[model samples]
Target: MGRVAGKVALVTGGGSGLGAADSELLAQEGATVIVTDVRLEAAQAVADRIGGAAVAMALDVASEAAWQQVIGDIEARFGRLDILINNAGVVVMADCEDTTLEQFRWVNAIMTDGVFLGCKYAIPLMNKGDGGSIVNMSSTGALLGYPIFFAYSAAKGAVRSMTKSIAIMCQDKGYKIRCNSVHPGAIETPMVQEASGRAGQAQAVPDGVLPAGAVGAPSDVAAMVLYLASDESRFVTGAEFVVDNGLTIRP
Candidate 1:
């Protein structure tokens, strides 16, 4: 419960899925959390669950002005930023010839651009304090391609590569920020369930099918977030932590 005590963390898309999980876990660990989402009600609900230490804000990741305001507000209220989790993303499946321009831009805007702006705003704020951590949500698709995840995979790949790019840049520029991306293959969450259901994909593995003999809960990812958000990973950055059940390694 103490891995991230006395810190302040902001999670974009904190209303649901991985973002909500990260926000909840961080708050449980004693960090003041800022839960931002496009859905004000959803964000407020999460913030309520986290109690007084957490607050909700409505935000659209694509707006630079809104981002500046959010950053400024956080700085004024929290006094310092300790962690920024760029965990907001969306996936739309369409093949190359059939993919629409709007779909492509929509995915990239939320996934890639949002991640880029997160690091952009967070790096300097983190430097204001001793240092901080930034964890971007990528996917196993970042390392490999899937026909159905054309846009999602492409954006995630960019996120993985961009993590390295900015990590090196921060190191060179002398900011004490460590940026990495987590690649999750499959997990049982509302978002995953809904996506698969809509696609008519097979249900997740039957219970006990995992190599570890258990499906991953959001806590698994939250554990990684705790490590990245703490000094425990002070020397680790610019890396991809693949959290799949060896799915990416299989032939």
Candidate 2:
């Protein structure tokens, strides 16, 4: 049951959806979880639910200054940061032709740049102890050509590549850090629910998009995160773990 006991985890976007689930699950496994989101009140609510095992903080993932401040606070408070989950992301559903420069930049800033900053800052703190694990949340869009989500797919593609780069760099530099990306497809989150409405569909995954029933829950992804954060995946790095209900392999 104690998958990550005594670890210190910081989950960006920990206010709702997958982030809230990740925070709660991490705390349940005996880790001190720092829940950070742009929505301070929502973050606080998640933390309160986790009781003494968690704390809430405000973070705008696109800001380098905020990243620095939070990492510093983690070092000061926990003395060691064992896990960093760069799960903060936004999806702009517009095809390549219709997407604007602003939309493209905004998505990349949060999904790509945010993950970069988290790894850049958290590595040193992780190195202080036994090294740490960094989990970047990508999407099935990163692996496929989803015409409906041009910008999101592009940003998540960058995240996937960056994860591999970080993993190799750490290996070469003799840091014990492990970096990997998680790609989830059609998960049951507010984001997906919104997407469903916009796409004029009853379910987030269209009938033929997946081989069979394909929607999943936040806890499904959290279980994978826990394994990555724990010592169980010590040798697993530079990998893309897909929790897509076989959607990627279909057709």
Candidate 3:
């Protein structure tokens, strides 16, 4: 049951959707979780529900100051960080021709820049102990062309590339930290529901076996996150894991 026993993990956007699921699973496996989100109350709610060594903090990923503050707090409180999940993101529903510069920059700042900062700051802390793992949440959009999610696709693409670079760097430098990216397609999360115009509607899929292009559950992606966060993936690094119900392979 203790897949990540005694580890100290930090999850960005731990308030809801995939983030909440990740935090819950990590804690279930015996890790002390720090849940951070732009919304303090949301993060706090998740933390309270989980209850234990889990705590909540407000963090604006795009701001260096906020990152510094959260990391500093972690250093002061826990003294070591074992897992970092860069999962916070925002999407703008606009194609290339219609997307404004502001929209593009906003999405990239949160997803792209946020992942960069998380890795940059968390590595040194992880290096302090037995190295750790970093999981960046990319999307199928990064692999396939997503015209309607222009900025999101761009940001996720950057995340995918950056994950590989960070993994290689850590390896070359003799660091034990491993970095990987996850590409999830059409997960049934609040963000996806709202973006797809099904926010308040029920989504039905087959029980035991999902169809080729059915939307997946948050647990599907969280399972991958759990594996990456655990020592079970000790030999895995610089890899891309896709949990899209085979949607990316359809002709």
lDDT of each: 0.85, 0.91, 0.95
Better of 1 and 2 by lDDT: 2
Full ranking by TM-score: 3, 2, 1
List model 2 lDDT by residue over 4-49, tens digit each.
Answer: 9999999999998899999999999989999999899999999999
Instruction: Point out where model 2 deviates above 4 Å.
Output: 198-211
Best by TM-score: 3
By lDDT, the candidates rank as 3, 2, 1
**lDDT-best of 2 and 3:** 3
Write model 1 residue lDDT over 7-35, tens digit each, in one string. Answer: 99999999987888899999998899999
Question: Which 10-residue window in model 3 sums to the lowest lDDT?
Answer: 200-209
Give candidate 1 misplaced runs (Cα > 4 Å). Answer: 198-215
Candidate 1 residue pairs in clash (backbone atoms < 3 Å): none
Report model 1's TM-score to 2 decimal places: 0.93
